[model samples]
Target: MSTFAVHLSYPSSPPGMKLVGKRYVSANAQQEGLPLVFTHYTGAHKELREPAIQKLFDLHSKRPTPAIRKAWAFAGNHGEAGVVNAGSLKSETNGLLHSLLSTLPPSSVSYRAIMFVEPSLITREMRLKHKAERRIAPRSCAR
Candidate 1:
């Protein structure tokens, strides 16, 4: 039997639905660093249609026994909007992540926080990294 790592991310919480865009990242896939399962909806339009997305969250929230809870969370940033829109896909994804994580057993990995950011947005932000942690940076460079 193989052990998998679980990670969750989401966009919004419907009135009856708890987790919405939760992702289940894996722990084994070397290429993944830590295996992850996260949901990504292109825009708000997708979030409005919550049935399929919420079901996805419910699926991940279930502990499969063999898997270990590594880490999980929700996070986002606003570009033009002055106030961060909690209703945005990015924000809702984070909310679902929180719900999925609540089901995990207490462990060291559970204590660590997960970062949720738009890949494109991060590129634009140009976050600086120190020499030692360069390996953590994404493979592609801007130029």
Candidate 2:
């Protein structure tokens, strides 16, 4: 499990670098090129959060993909804190799904039981479909 932070910034913009005395310092000071807006995962559940960040980065790098744009719009609609909570819930749900799929066969009754008990996975799937539909729909179309 992991926690991640996402930022929206231009791809070409240099990372938050500063000249401290004679030394230049940045988060990835030794590495060249600007860091992606959504970079690094930390916390006890960071492993879970990392993939979400990676997915967002993969979608948003160079230009904002539809999913990225939709996420941004979601944040805009819900507020920054709401987005953070949503991301955390999504990550946790993914971790649960991964654990379930990796440890249990599809035919296992326990697996089916857990899936039935946890509505988070179902909600996440519905949200994914909603995002996909939003992405496919033209911008001018009202939802």
Candidate 3:
């Protein structure tokens, strides 16, 4: 379940779909008023047949699990997703981390992969620290 409520135009949608996760943001106001998902798709998708995009959106919108919402995100500056685009990314990430922490786990290492589209944030310090850790080098400077 998500942290916010959703109201789809379809009257046939299951009532359970309207229920969002408990709004346990713990005082982070930015977490409020954000749409449940953002598909930041590239313009290349425009090449697809017109109905294809809408169909895909409809398919995914039917399943509002947090992980699916995160995966459905694409990379375009226009369309349904706007500033809530970045906010959705941050909020979903917070949810993932919190879920992990809440679960007691066996002693082991955890890994995460992120995609960053910028390069200016990549610095020598980041490179050195990463190398010192002896882990695989990251390919992006995503924050």
How well does each candidate superpose onto the true structure, as a TM-score? 0.24, 0.22, 0.17
Model 3, residue 18: what's the lDDT?
Answer: 21
Winner of 1 and 3 under lDDT = 1
For model 3, the local distance difference test gives 0.31
Model 3 bad stretches (over 4 Å): 1-70, 78-120, 134-143
Best by TM-score: 1
In model 1, which regions exceed 4 Å deviation?
Answer: 1-15, 18-33, 39-106, 110-115, 120-136, 139-143
Q: Please, what is the whole-model Cα lDDT of each candidate in the order they appear?
A: 0.34, 0.31, 0.31
Query: Which residue pairs show backbone clashes in model 3?
Result: 2-21, 39-74, 40-74, 40-75, 40-76, 41-74, 41-75
List, residue by residue over 1-143, the lDDT tens digit for candidate 3.
Answer: 11332222223322222212112121212322322222222332212222433443354456542222211223222232223234444434222212333444455754343333222355878767767453433223222
lDDT (0-100) at residue 4 of candidate 3? 33
| Better candidate by TM-score, 2 or 3 | 2
- Compared with the true structure, what per-residue lDDT tens digits does model 1 show for residues 1-79? 1222222233333332333222333333223233333333233322232353344334445633223333232222222
TM-score of 1: 0.24
| Candidate 1 RMSD to the correct structure | 12.9
Q: Which candidate leads the pack in lDDT?
A: 1
